[model samples]
Target: MNDDVTCISCPLGCRIHVEKKGDRITVVGHMCKKGEEYAIQEVKDPRRVLTTTVKIEGGRQCLLPVRSEKQIPKDLVKKCVIELSKIGIKAPIKCGDLVYKNILETGANIIATRDVESVEKK
Candidate 1:
């Protein structure tokens, strides 16, 4: 199978072509080593940092911005969001506060991205 992937490892955003045949893989069209590495890993196992909003109670806003502590499997992103959608947290929440730990057993914690003051505090 041959695939073209845009490398995000650097600012250049090199268009990388990856070819997989049985047990062998070849990467081309990368301008740097990081691009090459990204292409290989992207083809084998793609990962992405998850960023989304969750329900927040009694806060300045009805939603709280959150993100995965690290990149999780790309395939699990939707599942993680679905799980988070079912959760509701109370404010005031501080930035960097741990919202959810070991989310879906991906070893990535969902952390608050910004502070949300309680409505009563306002």
Candidate 2:
């Protein structure tokens, strides 16, 4: 099988051609080592950092921004989003605070991206 991939490891978006025969794989059109590695890994397993909003209770804002601390498997993104939707956090959250730990056992932490102050009651 032959596949074409664009390298995102650096500013140079190298269009790499990957050819897989049995267990052997050949990559071409990459200028750097990182590009070559990226092509191979992308073909095998792709990952991405998730950024989304979570429900916040008693905050100035209705929702709080959150993101995965590290990249997780692409396939689990939808499930993670669903899990986040079911959760509700309190107000007064600071940036970098842990929202969810070891999410789906992928070893990725969902952290708050911004500060949310608590709402004062009259």
Clashes of 2: 0
Predicted candidate 2 versus true structure: per-residue lDDT over 96-119, tens digit per residue: 999999999999999999999998
- Those runs of model 1 whose alpha carbons end farther than 4 Å from true positions after fitting are 19-26
Model 1, range 1-122, lDDT digits (tens) per residue?
99999999878889999999999999999998888888998998999999999999999999999999998999999999999999999999999999999999999999999999998997
**Candidate 1 — worst ten consecutive residues by lDDT sum?**
7-16
Per-model TM-score, in order, reads 0.84, 0.82
* Candidate 1 vs. true structure, TM-score: 0.84
lDDT of each: 0.95, 0.93
- What C-alpha lDDT does candidate 1 achieve relative to the native structure? 0.95
